[model samples]
Target: MNDLDIRCAAPSDIAAVLRFWREAAEGTSITDDHEGVARLISRDPEALLLAEQDGRITGTVIAGYDGWRCSAYRLAVHPDRRRQGIATALMDAAERRFLALGGRRIDAMVLESNERAHRTWGSAGYHREGHWRRWVKSVRP
Candidate 1:
């Protein structure tokens, strides 16, 4: 394997990213389309991180920080590239971004059904918060 290039997503990369997610990511999101991703990069240029190896995107993670919280989402690696430190590298980069932004802690959004993600996050020192459950409503226009 070659050295991984971890970088922010550009506007031109949105289409490729959506395609990559379809193949590599475990699940889908309401904001997985081109417009949503473009909005993300437009709003916060550094929030979306991509892992590239030999000119192909192999992994990705969204590291978003509001004034009050640091949220991580969309952590995915290519099926063929699992257990190869790509996810770790992406998380490391996200953690560094949060730390630089004065973030005290990180909250990652991992799907409950993804047992593989559970182990992956657990090994990264994240534990499930048994007391709290997420509540959400889609405000689509």
Candidate 2:
């Protein structure tokens, strides 16, 4: 294993990222497509971070800071690459990004059924807030 390189995603990496998600990520999102990801990179170039080792992408995390709030999404690591500190590195990068942007706190979206993710997040010092429930509506125009 080589030193992992964490950097913001570029447009050229979209296809590879989508495919990586299908294999590594637990769930899908409305903005999983190329256009949607492109829009994200265009709007906030530093939001999507990719972890690469020896030129292959091993992990990813979306560290989005909308000036007021810091939101973490799509924290994924290749199945073959799990338990190898890839996720920890990604989270460390995301947290650093948030702190640099003056973000006081971070909210991560993890699936209820994803026990693996829960453990991962918890080990990273994140606690699930039972008081707040997420209410979402799929609004596709």
Candidate 3:
């Protein structure tokens, strides 16, 4: 396996990232569109982290810090590229970025049914918070 190149996503990478997520991610998000992603890159240039090898996107993770809380989203790895340490590399980069930004804690939003993701996150020392539940409301709709 070639060493994956891990870095922040640029505006030019938005389309490829959306395509990659459609193929690799478990589920879609409401804001997975080009405009949303572009807006994210525009707002926080280093929030979306990507892993590539041989010119193909292998994995991605959104490590967003709003100067207060650090949250991770869209942690996806290509189906064919799973178990090849790509996710780990992406997480490593994300953690480093968070630490550099003085983030004290990091939280990830993983689906309850995504056992693979649970295992991945567990291996990285993340535990599920049974005491807390997430509530959401779409402001756009």
Candidate 4:
């Protein structure tokens, strides 16, 4: 097992980042949502992070940090790389980056069907303070 190289993703890393997103998580909106990603990165570069090993992408997470609280969201580890502490490592960096940016609290919203995510977040020191059945109506034409 080659040691993984964890770092902040740049515009040059988009292809690898998108590849990981596709192969890592299929059902979730992470991979297929590249346009959204472009917008986010354009808005804030630190939102998307990647972990690579031997130059091969292994893990990824999407985070957003405003002036207020840090938002850790859309975490994913390549299918072949799951359970290797990749996700945790990514989260560690993310939290640190957020703190460095003067963020106060960290928050995330996990889907109710995603039990594995719930457990992962909990194990990663996150707790459920509340829940919401959010309603959204997209005005797509």
Write down the TM-score of every candidate. 0.97, 0.96, 0.96, 0.83
For residues 1-141, what per-residue lDDT tens digits would candidate 3 score against the true structure?
Answer: 457898889999999999999999987777989989999999999999999998899999999999998999999999999999999889999999999999999999999999999999999999999999999876783
lDDT of 1 by residue, 22-97 (tens): 9999878789899999999999999999999988999999999996799999999999989999999999999999
**Local accuracy of candidate 4 as per-residue lDDT tens digits, 1-141:** 348777777777776677776677635553255676677778888788888887888887777887887887768887777888998889988988887888878887677787888888899998887654556555543
lDDT of each: 0.94, 0.94, 0.93, 0.77
Ranking by TM-score: 1, 3, 2, 4
Tens-digit per-residue lDDT, 1-141, candidate 2? 359999999999999999999999988888899999999999999999999988989999999998899999999999999999999999999999999999999999999999999999999999999999998887788
lDDT for 4 in candidate 1 is: 93
Query: Which residue runs does candidate 3 get wrong by more than 4 Å?
Result: none
Best by TM-score: 1
Model 3 poorest ten-residue lDDT run: 1-10
Worst 10 residues of 4 by lDDT: 25-34
lDDT of 1: 0.94
Stretches of candidate 2 above 4 Å error? none
Residue 17 displacement in candidate 2 (angstroms) = 0.5
After superposing candidate 1 on the true structure, give the runs of residues whose Cα lies further than 4 Å from its correct spot.
none
The lDDT ranking, best first, is 2, 1, 3, 4
Assess candidate 3 and give its TM-score to the true structure. Answer: 0.96
